[model samples]
Target: MTWSSALKKTARDGLTIERTRLEPLLALRGAAGVAIVVGLLLAFGTPKLAVSSAFGAFAAGVATFQRTWRPRVTLAVVVAVGLGASTFLGYLAAPHHAVFVALLAVWTLLAGMAWAVGPVSGLVATQTIAVMLVTVTLPTSVVGAAHHAALIVFGGLVQALLVVLVPIRRWGRQRDALADALAAEADYARRLRHDPTARFDPQPLMDARDAAELTRRQARYRPGQLAGPRGVAERLRPVLASLADPVLGAPAEGPERDRVRDLLGAAATVLDAVARAIRRGEPVRLPPEAMAVLEVPESGPLLSGPARRSALRLIALLGDVVEASDEPVRTTGPATEQERRDLLRPSVPRLVPVALRAVRREARWSSPIARHAVRVSAVSCAGYLLAAGLPLGHGYWAPMTSVMVMRPDFARTYERGVARFAGTLVGVGVGGVVTAFLHPGVYVSAALAVLCIGLLYLLMRTGYSVTSACIGAYVVFLLGIAGEGWSQTVQARLALTLLGGLLAMAAYAVFPAWETPRLRDRLAGWLRANGEYALAVLAVYARPAERKARRVREALLDSRAARREWEDASARARKEPVRHRGLSRSAERAAEAALATMGRVTMLMEAHLPDRQAAASPGAEEFASALRAALPDAIAAIRERARPDWSGPRRALAEWQRREGDTGVAVRGAELLTDALDELSEGLAAPRRGRAGRGAGRG
Candidate 1:
């Protein structure tokens, strides 16, 4: 090759490399800016502080990246209060050999306290540990610790203030993000629709599913902790609900219905993809084929005039903004009336009630019982430490911290316990080695400190297992610095850690904070919520209007979430050999029935309103009333296990469905509603029959 050509090629390759590398580096720089500000504040502020301000600042950065914060002011206040209180406590308990140890204890205690309140509590606890280790370890005296704590606090507060005050021009970006997700979903749906025989592709679909799941999970955290972007799940809920509706089944011989359905499905896929991308902390990317499909302008009443214009504009903006920001978009954009209508169009039969149920599922994770369990576990850990009378060092604080940090699930608790025990043993052993060979000095200690930080940052970024190993290494280093003989120190530290792990495990498993048993109750609640949402949707559908359909779609999303949660809980429960089989089976059946109900509801809604352009009919009103009335009884059946009596509503719906005249459409809807009611009745009865069959088989 010629030298000039070679040089040009090299330049092109270098530019590509630089671009790829720079994006992440820039993101990191943004993170570091937040950390530096926090570090500076810690270096100067609060004397004898336990937890560091840098932690809070870093947390603010994380929250910003997550785009979770809503009502930014509230988030800022909560963060400030939590960090300040932890710092103050640390400052008050300074000047002792075990001051750092005490700080760990305080952090765990506070975090546990927060977890009891909600998921945000756990996040706060994690931030506390990260900040304190970074900011406080350098100081030798209580006074120095306090000053560092103040500096850290200042840094965090500044970061929070900046985030709150900064007016990001995100509307265009958000709109673009939504559009991208919609376009992707539409393309996926079109592919699926066309293939007819194609099964769901687990890989691509998994990412989208994960994204939706993550959005729902993250929503449990305090509003301001992450960017308060409108989630893809929320945005696409209406569309998905419409698709699930039975009334909108196999499109009649018309291009409009087909086109709209494809668009709605594509939107669902895109939302799922966008949600997943955000959760993974990556920029959203559209599938090329899907993008190509979306670009095509298929003529249809659905894509005509203003509605079509709005969708195209929305999609174009989403593509442009997502490309420009280089960050995952948050759900902050306002929903347009047309966009909202498209979302709410009850194409899927019986969608209103089903969607409501799905949304209610989303709400279940934030329920009081779940929050209580986390809190009680935290309190229990603290109580164990105080009762043991173990010295205020790694021995007392490590175990307590573990309990507060571990998830409410048994599997997570078990893994964390094992990791904690192993890490403690290894760390103590390493500490002994260092103490025996190299005397603890300023240089050795400083080297160890830096090593600890590097290990923590790296391992934590990787996964839980690596993080456990790093924790172990850190503890060993810390013990060596405590001026003890190698053998004796190692033995003592190991024994203490074992005790702490046991106590933590006990606290997690014990009463006043039981998690496993509560799964059943949570499932029950989800079912009840699903029923309520379904009823609401039915009421809205009775009056043929876009607004009512939108409500129905929202409710269906809630039901879907509930079903997903129930499935997760059931899977977890089954993993335990000692799990209550009876309860598990009952919960599973309830979940199944709920899922079926949601699906049926989606179908019914769609059948009633096959075309959005159609005017309301009298029969639509009658069917709506019947659905509303039936919903309460259906819910009661699921919750109370009462047999569903569909005789009255079934007859009314059947008459409407079979009626033939000027109100032929209304009559058809009534017939579908009748079928839906019958199916629901069967669904309610199946669980009981299954239980009986199981019992008979066992006998």
Candidate 2:
């Protein structure tokens, strides 16, 4: 991609307004919490105190919208505690410019590194720094600072308490996550009826796994419908693929293939019902047609041996899903070890060390997170100093805009910069009109600010532009309590916002951590993960054991994560203006396709994994060894931009094919996998061949 094209694409991305589901009830609850905190403060204290404390309430409410695995109350409390701590520290540092700038650099740096944990953690951390930048001006002395901090903490606690007492859609996140996974598989099954080789995105299943993790306390109240179905949906994916694969289960054009398609359709319907049941917290309503399809005898000649077995397994898993839906919610008893293990979350206080450790690990220069930290820190400090040097009174707005808008990637940083500036402009314009025309008193200003906050919550998911507009009005009305009218804010706010946004974009353009340069590394990592999955499954066949079963499960998870990483890199790289250094766009696409094909073949083999007490598959040991040895070399070849050799696997595959006489499902899948690898080798070699041909012509 060229720079011009990249800019054009990012501009459209920035301007694009997504259509999100309307959550009026949830939005109202969040806004009501903010109103409660502000109202109580105004009744007991001054208007300034209420306005300052509103930051904590607003931030806590925003935390609930984060897409994290943590409970809503936990997130709210954690965010509140951070707000209080940041307020105390910021107040102490505000009196001295030097101390404050130093603190800003360090705080923003940590906030940048927080991305290493996840986006939610990073967003929460950055929001604290932005809030600190604004609220520090509210406190005058040490005692005053403590009082302000306590009030902020009180506001957050109020929000958290509302989460507990009101409890809109209790355990809603868990149910939705589990239901989404089933829904994804249902969709996949429907797609496979037409495209037998359709690839399944593992994101939903991964989300389901994350949702299933529960603390002992949480587990005691676990809803039974959420349980059992997660694992069943997970195991069903491979069997569905296996049953649909022409090489594994059916003829390319025959009655068996038709039956396979029909089975997939029925599976999709059944799974969809289960998903709806789980989502609605109702009993499983099995569709009559799907039940009839499942009840069909597997003794027919349409499917034989392993094919028939896959069909039976699919039905059994579907039955398990239906049975589990009827289970009553469990309200008592100790959580199982399987439910608690590493999935058990530490309390918020203990979580700080874990977060700190993760940030420290990403502090090295090679980490993109570290580079982002450096970028934000420098941009924030520069924006603040520049704003201060000029006549812009509220200099914090500059650095606050930079901090909130900047992200780790070029696309987001640039897109958000443009979006934030435009949003703030529109936001301030509306706010100026309201204050100039209405001239609301202190109580009315508070009411208008609360209304703005409510709209901010309501429109948050619509797009950043809409939310930014509301935030603009919110700030205007909020500071009105301190007697800063529209005239004082109109000029300074818009100018400083533009300055900060420009600074953030320039910082990224000058020091970008381009994903294009690392495309080969990402591809190699994916290849290694794919090989590990294939080898794990083959090892189970070579020598079945309970340990290998666990290994296979772990490998499957690792491979899915790796696949997501590669896909993300590819997507980011395409948007980047930087030229691909080692891997061309065509080669990248082909390599990804080949890898996906190989993965599907491996999954088909895994669908018929031998029982622990059963005899090992013939020649499984040789094939596993050969494939295992080839993977490291293949990964190395990928990194070097050379053709990968898989002769050993090919030899073993041929021998196994001949030994198996009739060519079993595993042997056939292995042949397909090797064919996919051959395609991968050709893809990696094409760029080299192109360059060589050009060199020869020049010579």
Candidate 3:
């Protein structure tokens, strides 16, 4: 064949192959959708069912899809029990209002829990409530309800079978994504220490590190069931463990990536040293030469300006911590100082704000306005259905589906919404066409049920929106089996669904609740909490006895969480106005440093503990109490100064640090503390004339 003809053939062949590969995915998604729709209809629409089996199917599918064993099992059991109890109660009451009350109770309880606990819980709750509501509302005899329940159970079984059998590979994909994220974080952190020019924009590196951490967690939760080279969680365990290392400034070296690797490795050593010091409980001394080695400029040829600055700051901060600990080591030994304070002080100042921001950005869906908008849309959809005189089932399902898919992120919400609308439209149209051809019978319904399952499986593979659309179509088709005709009813249902989507969209966009304002306070509070917790841990560690280590460890963990929360909060605050930013930015960095220092102190504390439990020193105990008492006030001062207009808080913090002699121990502990306080004062006092102008200019 000529070259042109060959090229064309090759292109066509590639396209065909692509389509062929996609066929199974499409089929699976469609089947999953069908299964969910059929289950819902049988459980909620039919007279025989008193509880929703569809929801059970949905919960099971989510579990199978996510590959999380505990949550899936928990959700399934909870939903089953909830639905069964509601059904039994409704049956016992027998009166018209009794079923209504039971349904309301179930819906409220489930919806509330779902709102609080996330999708898995929500799925279970929604199903239980839906089934209860349907059973109570339908004018069905007890035997009929039992039969419906059987059908619902059958539908759930079908859903489970389809989900378990389908080879969608969702968990595998998620795991891969998580692994990629962790690798990126490792790369970024390594670069921060090795690359000088990289300092110009530390945000990217920081962001990558944060993403990596999140992805690591995600991987742990959703590692694919398939056997692999190493489980995602297993691969990530080393990375998470390394995060606690105090000496994170050094990197590791590889063949081509020798510089960063070496730096990370060095950092890891420092962390090891710090951990050792904290465990010892007094002070662990790093050789002067080691301190010098740790002082290498973070900004090198490979780094950017912002990244270099950030790295430099971090290294300098670590140096200060190491230097301060020197005197403490010579004096009482590691456990003489409290463990929590050592871990918390350096990190709480910087990390807390960043973590808070991350959480806010991720969980901003908790806005009241967003909730209201969804409710309004649901109400609007229901109103339209009522006006159009469509069946109660059709109206309720249309709006319920719409609200479930609504999100604060416009793009995501829109995508899912459109897919759902399309799926519903298609499902309704197909159901009408099928009803026209086949007489309503158990055999026909069962066949349709199977078809729905297959479609649901396909939809699940595609996307949530598409899945909703397929499910909608399947639900309408099932209605046909119940003697509803496709004629005008299909058109009416479509119109009502469209209305629901519109209302949901309108609610999402108009007067939406913004999380911007709360960012600052969240960061500040988190930092304060971390600082306090850290001090508490340190106090326990300072007892001069080994028994306090467990308490110190627990307190340190709590402080770590608080620090993370602070960091995330701060990061989010940066996205808003200056006043709303609070102390998040600087606080996050400081917190991280403090935590590293604390880790070192912890190592020292552990090492100093007597082999045979020794009596606690009164001096050490008094010092611990004093430090604990001072930490809250000092942290509060810093936080107060974090305000746009306040410099006084910073001054006060500087004074306190100086008076307490907080500098670990390159000098006298008292002298180091005095120096730190002075430095803080100087730093706080430095004119921000140009900086304020720039910030104001931006405003």
Candidate 4:
């Protein structure tokens, strides 16, 4: 794609508004916290104090809305405390221009590096830099700075306290995640009734697992229902796959197929019912007919051998799900203790070492995250200086815009830059009109800010542009309370905001953390991870043991993580200006399909993994070792543009089939798996620049 087309596409993307659900109660609750902080100070102390401290409450509220696994109360406290510290420190440095800029560079650097931890942490940390620049402008002595910082802390604590007191959706995130996972399985089962080769994304299960992770305090109060359903749903994946796969579970035609469909339909019904019950925190309500279908036929067996066993296992698992739901609503009982051990999230105070290790991994120059750190740190100082020299009334607006809009990627930074300028144009105008028309005093301005905050909360998920608009209006009203002109400072604000956004855009254009160049690297990482996962599954068949089962589970998770990384990199690379970097567009599509097939085959094998007492499958040990031996060579070939060494695995599979023809279901899967790997190698060896539909559909 050309630069103009990419620019137009990104611009169009930036303007697109999405439909989103609104949490009116949650939004009101958050806004009320901000309003309370602003109100109490305005009523008693002073406008400046109220406005300065309001940043803490406002920021804390914003942090709660991020897609984080951490407790909302924890987010509020940590984010607020960071803001307070940044504000106090920023105040001290404000007296010296060089020192303040230096501090900002360091802060931005750290904030950028925080992305190594997670998006939530990075976003929350970045906000502190913006707040630091804005709040430090409040003129104060050292002691006064301390006082302002304390009030900010107080304001943040107030929001956290509200999160605890109201508890609108206590354990809501966990319930939603678990329900989503169950629903996904239900959907997968329904899909299998039609297309047995149907694929399932494990993301929902991953989300449920993440939501299950709790600090010790959190684990104590966690509901019992969240626990058993997730594990049961997890086990059901393989069983569903096993039942659907022709090689392992059911035949393609006749009475067996009909029974398979009927059983699947029944299971879907049961899963959907359980999902609905969990989502609403209501009693489990099973469909009578569906339960009847689950009962084995009295006359004769519909499915023989493996299919029967799979059906029985699935029935037992569903029964476990129902039983888990029957536990008392609020329990700190044995389930709680077991879940605590199963899903322990480290306490915040204990995260220092973890943070250090994560940051250390991303510290190398080769890391895109590290490059982003350098880019943002340098851009922060440059934007601040340029905006300061332009005589803007609120110079920090320029740098803050840059900081907020700039991400580590090309698409987001450009998209958000455009959205920021456009939103600011409309937002400042609306805020200006309100202030000019009403001639409102500090109290009225405070009310307007609170209204904007409420809108911000309710519509934050709608789009980036909407969020930018709300924030712009909020800053306008907030500054109005701090004694900015009642007239719309539209011209000044827009000019500075545009300048900041442009700097952000230019910075990325100059030195980007492009996913395009890293596409091959991502694919190679995924290939290695997927190979390990497949090998682990093969090992379980070779030597079926409890320990191997654990190994298989761990390997599956690692592959899932790797797959996500590859998927994310490809998604980002699609929007990038550099379309063909390491892989041509067509090659990428084929390679992606090949990778998906590899993952799916292993997942199928994983589903029917044998019991500890079962005999080892034919050639499992030899084939697994061959795949393991070939994996490193394949990874290197992907990177070095050489022929992949699949000979070992091929020989193993051929030898197995020769010595023991058609006996091993896993051998059939391994054959298909090797076929996909060969396709992946061909994709890398030559870029398929054929007709649009041709190269894309090969896998």
Candidate 5:
């Protein structure tokens, strides 16, 4: 696709705003949790001591607000441990500037590299850094540090209790995930009903299923329990995949086709209804008409073919799910019970081994996350020194901003820096007016803190700007409760925040990992995967008895995943400031065209039911070999920036087509596929020896 067309497609399907009704409930829960913790501390202890309690509550609220109880427990444990360590580190290093900078740098490096594992691990590590920096100003000896640490743990415990005791929506995240997966399947089926040759992207549905499964595993439900909607959703997944097949979806047009479409349409409606009912914890109530659509005659003019047979099976599956609503929950464990038991049994210590393994895995010099970690550590250390040397009141804010704004990619880092600075400025202005005018007491300040924190949680996913603004307001009210004046705090924070943003931007400038350089490898990977998938499909036609349906399916999935990765890489590369001039636009277009043609070839191969006799057709194996060889040459040509001859593959395809008794569809698919290969080869024949081009920026 051209740049303009790609942008339009992205606007249509890429940027989606998810509207979750439970945001209000989550916000309320987070606020109430903080309020309860603060209220108890004020009732039992002095106002000054309540600061520790507030910190604890805030940590717990942030950690477990959206997670289920089981993950909540683990996350709470980690937060408490990290908070304790942070307090100790701060206390130990605060007495000496040199010692503090050294320790902070080490922590920042480790925390930044933790991002390699995943987003959750990254969050935990970053939060630990934030807590340590924020609490470094507290006057604490060894004994006092231990006391503060205990209070922080107590605060997290209180938050956990609030979540467990006052959940607004039971299993909300899990239910929503499952509901979304089912809903996506229904949508895909609906599309197939209208157009058999429609292109289906499996990533969204797969992602939903993966999320739901993760939630189910983490939940503290009874072992092997698959109750209510969870079980139904799992059973529906494989059925939905089969229904999406072109062969089943596009039957011969007549009364049979009409009946099949009607059944499918009704089934999609029923699935949607079930998804909603699952989300709301309501009873499943299929309309009477929906059931009647499933009662078509087995031998009538509308129901006597393979298509009707498949439709009957689908209807029967739906009926069984509805009729068997009252049975005990059926568990489909990922592994056998014995295996789970064996793995969990006590053995020799493995913690050190696992830790070493992970370290070795992420220690590579070429790894993006590792390079980013180094950048963060260097910038953080520099920001700290700059802040301390200046007249800034709080030296930690600059380092904190530097750490928070920097992400794995250039675009995200710059975007986040802009959002953080703007949000903090607005927050400081609004907070200054409120604190100076109202001069609220401890109770009122705590209430405001709760409200602001609630807003912060509510807006975090929607937009970084709003979330940052809420965070700023929250910090102001929290300072009020801690007896710090807003006017003094706001100015210092603003200066430090700007410094931090600048430091983040400067770090990226000095040590860049631009995506443009990686596009060649990404495209090559995609071509190789598609080649393997096409070869696998063709191999089935070459030797019918050796064809494995499972292998073919796996190959298709791999190809699709590779294609997605390449597309994402291309988009990110486009956002970079420069592109390799050697990689011309024509080459990019040809690469995409080749992949499109490959898809059509795969589809034709999938639709054809090859017999054992067809395997003996002259030059069939030679044709398959030629197509397989062409893909590597194409990929090599792109990488080396040199053209290869395409005549060999084209001639092989033509010879195979002229051979006696080959199916028309197979011959046509080969011809089109070879033509695409010719185009791709021609596009990549030029050598790389030109100045770089300025990338066309993304919207």
Candidate 6:
């Protein structure tokens, strides 16, 4: 694409906004909470106290809203503690310049590294650092600072209380995610109807699946998600993915193609309704006509190809899910409201174990997250030192910007830097005008600050640039009460933001941790995980069905994680500064083919199991052994970057298929296992291409 086209595309994408149905309501609630707290404080107290109270309100707005009540309350408490502690320390250190600088550096580094913990912890850390920066600049005694911080904490609690009191569609996010995944699948299937060879982008589907799973996990830490439509959604994800590929079954054209297209539309419609029902907390009511499409049989005289077979399976699966969605939410025991709350209630005993595991996970120096922590700490300290030595009035901007932009991956680091700069510029301009012309009284200024905070919450997920712009305006209005005018601070912000971006780029250049170098290992991991999943699935034929299903579930989860890691690594590799950094075109194709084979194997595993007596087949055990051996060999070959012969595994699978005489569970599993092995071998065998393959390689 040309520069102009690219610019246009960026603008279009940036302007495209996204929000949950309840987001606007949440934003309003947050704004109201801040307004109420600040307004009440301003009525009888000094402007400083009122402003400090807004800090709590702003924290609540930024972190506590939009989450379930349990997490919201927990976040509210954390924000309160973080703001109060930072304020107290900032007060004590404010008299000594060197101590203050060190304090800022330490806080920034710790905040930057908090991303190693999780997304929420990182957000709170960043917010805490911002509070410290502003707090230290204020003129207050230690006691006064504590009082102000306490007020801020109170503000966050008030906001949290509001969220709990006024409930909206609690499962809106999860429902929307499942609906989007289903809709994306339907769209992919529709495209296949017109162009049978169309390559599907599984990212959307994959992302939606990940989001659904994340929500489920979060529900374990919070109440209110007890009735979320998780069961049907989880089962429906793979079914949708299976329908995306055309080569899976018989070729449909003409009337068959029309029938497939209709089915796709109907499926999308049913899922859309399911989404609405979930959001509304009601049972799905599919129309009579929609129900008719699901009745189509897998084996009929009119349809005979593999495509027909796959289509029939998809139809049946959709019907089952539709029925499942109609059932009441399942509970483990007597699941009362109190029981649900108890399950998510905080316990030190439970948390200590989880925290220990998290610590162990982050302890590995060679882990990607560890490398990210080190890089972020280094860059943030460097940015601080550079700004300190210069004449910049608010040197905190340098470290703050660096910490915000330096993500674990390359693409985010570059993208966020540009967006942050652009957004800051827009925000500084708007804030400058507001501060200079309006010269508003305390009430108006307070209201303006509240409005900006609300906008910040609403625009956060849209893009970094838009969010930063809103944040810039918010900071200007916020700092105005702290004695800094927008006119004076705007220039420093713009310049420091630019400098911070450059410093982050330089830091990565010097102490690099590029993803391309790690792609091979990630691919190897995926190979082994998929191999284990395949083995576990095949074992179902020999072992008890109940026991093997649990193993299959565990293996599938591991494989999915590995697959996502590999895809993420490949994406980052594409943007690495090094030439020919990513996999070659042929290698990428091989990886994709392997993924397809894995999907097939997963479907086979999830399919209805045959009797364990099927293990009596003479060739079953021999085939299983060969299949098991192929994965380890593939892993070793990928690690050594060498090609391995697949002849033995191929022969074993072919022999098993011939002996079985039909496509039973064992035969299907063996066939997919062979295909996956072949693909991995092909990927490993493909010669590496240099920079010449850069643009045309895997996306």
- Highest lDDT: give the candidate number: 4
**Is candidate 3 or 6 superior in lDDT?**
6
Off by over 4 Å in 6: 1-22, 65-70, 96-106, 181-229, 236-269, 296-320, 327-352, 389-392, 543-547, 580-582, 612-615, 662-665, 688-699
What's the CA error at residue 604 for candidate 6, in Å? 3.6
lDDT of 3 by residue, 447-529 (tens): 56557655565445555645565566655554555555567557766776676666655555564433345543444455455
Model 5: lDDT to the true structure = 0.67
Q: In candidate 1, what are the lDDT values of residues 1-699, reduced to their tens digit?
A: 233443344233222211111224323433453445533433543312212343455445444433332333334445655565555555555335366455555555445444443355356555554444333324444665555555555655665666445534322233334334444544545553444222222223222333322222233331221232344323332333333232333343366457655654555455455555544446666666556545657543445432344346445544543443346334434434453333232222343365445434433435433443444345444644453475533344444445533565544554556666665565556656766687765336434633653444433434344444555555454444444345655665566556655665555556223334555455555655565555554454454455465566556556656656666665555443243423435435544554555444543443334344555555555655666666656556645556556576665665555653423433544454455456545544554564663331100
Model 1 poorest ten-residue lDDT run: 14-23
Answer with 2 or 3, whichever has the higher lDDT: 2
Candidate 5, run of 10 with poorest lDDT: 342-351
Ranking by lDDT: 4, 2, 5, 6, 1, 3
lDDT of 3: 0.43
Q: Which ten residues in a row have the lowest lDDT in candidate 2?
A: 690-699
> With candidate 1 superimposed using the best TM-score fit, by how many Å does residue 472's alpha carbon deviate from the native?
2.8
Candidate ordering by TM-score (highest first): 2, 4, 6, 5, 1, 3
Residue pair clashes in candidate 6: 249-306, 249-307, 250-306, 250-307
Per-residue C-alpha lDDT of model 4 across residues 1-699, encoded as one tens digit per residue? 556876887888887789977889989999999999999999888988898889899999999988877889999999889988998998888888898999999999999999998898899889899888886467857987788888888889999999999988878878889999999999999999898889788899899889888788776677866757888898998898788777778898878988899999999999999998888888888979999999889774489766777888888988888888756567454444543565788888987788889999999998888988899899889988887888657788888998998888888888998888888888888888887788888877899999999999999988888988998889889888878884536667898999999999999989877777777788889999999899889988888754366677888889889988888888887788765445666677778888888988898778777778888765888998888888998898877756577889999999888877855667778888889898887776565334343333211
Q: Which residue pairs clash in candidate 2?
A: none
Q: Give a tens-digit lDDT track for model 6, residues 415-485.
A: 77777888899998898898999887677777787888888776666667878898888778867765676
Q: Which stretches of candidate 4 lie over 4 Å from their true place?
A: 334-342, 545-547, 686-699
Model 2: per-residue lDDT, tens digit, 22-49?
A: 6777788888888888788788888888
lDDT (Cα, tens digit) per residue for candidate 5, span 226-293: 23444454445334433434443334576656665677677778777766765665667778787777
| TM-scores vs. true structure, each candidate | 0.61, 0.96, 0.52, 0.96, 0.80, 0.83
